[model samples]
Target: MSNIVIYHNPKCGTSRNTLALIRHAGLEPTVVEYLKTPLGKEELRALVAATGEPVRALLRAKESQATELGLNDPTVSDEALLDAMAAHPILMNRPVVVTPLGTALCRPSERVLELLPVGPLPPFTKEDGEVVNDSGARRA
Candidate 1:
């Protein structure tokens, strides 16, 4: 197993960009195509714990099924969200990066930097044209 791993969704632009950033950082990560390799409840819980984020935070609220299943309701419990995410992989957010430093949801993609060691990060421009400098700070 590589030192780093990414629960990735190739179809998601943020996920794709995060993966590319990991590669550009000179680390070959173990990519888990989560939709195909759907995570179990235990795995999902562990991932959420690793990121120090609540299960609800890891959920993709915008996922169509989230609304249909009433997962968008604030009253939904963590267990409920975790169960839904386990049943519908798409309910889980994309590009959760895990490294020795830590794990992150990588929503903006740049959040992956926090999981990398202190070193030069890959300079990349996001789809929005925001450039991530070598220091991992975004530049116009």
Candidate 2:
């Protein structure tokens, strides 16, 4: 077992499920409530790099502020997006789990399982399950 850090938002169902999966996998993860303690610019940038995605990919596009601030506009620069995410934690995507081996975006609760060491997680049933798609819907 290695250091597993989860950037979580308890309010989000997917985030909650991801945490549950982590615990079920038998690996203790350091949960960072990103909304309470927002990530700095450097950390945010590093996370994006770790995920191998553009800065915009880490943003919560549904956030009202994202639209209010015109973040969706292609004209926005990467620095501006990073600043926005750093300033508004809600704009940062939820449940990003990082391990020494690699990092993953736990959008769908199942994705978090990939980061865990080989083990059987608690059975995922219909009741406590949600699937995240590219569109970001929590299909229960």
TM-score of each: 0.91, 0.85
Residue-level lDDT of model 1, residues 37-87, one tens digit each, is 999999999999998888888999999999999999999999999999999
Q: What is candidate 2's CA lDDT for residue 12?
A: 91
lDDT value for candidate 2? 0.80
- Candidate 2 — which residues are off by over 4 angstroms? 126-140
User: Per-residue lDDT tens digits of candidate 2, residues 11-123?
Assistant: 89888888877776677899899988999999999999999878888899998999999999988999999999999899998889987657878787778766666444446
Q: lDDT (CA) for every model shown?
A: 0.87, 0.80
Specify the highest-TM-score model's number.
1
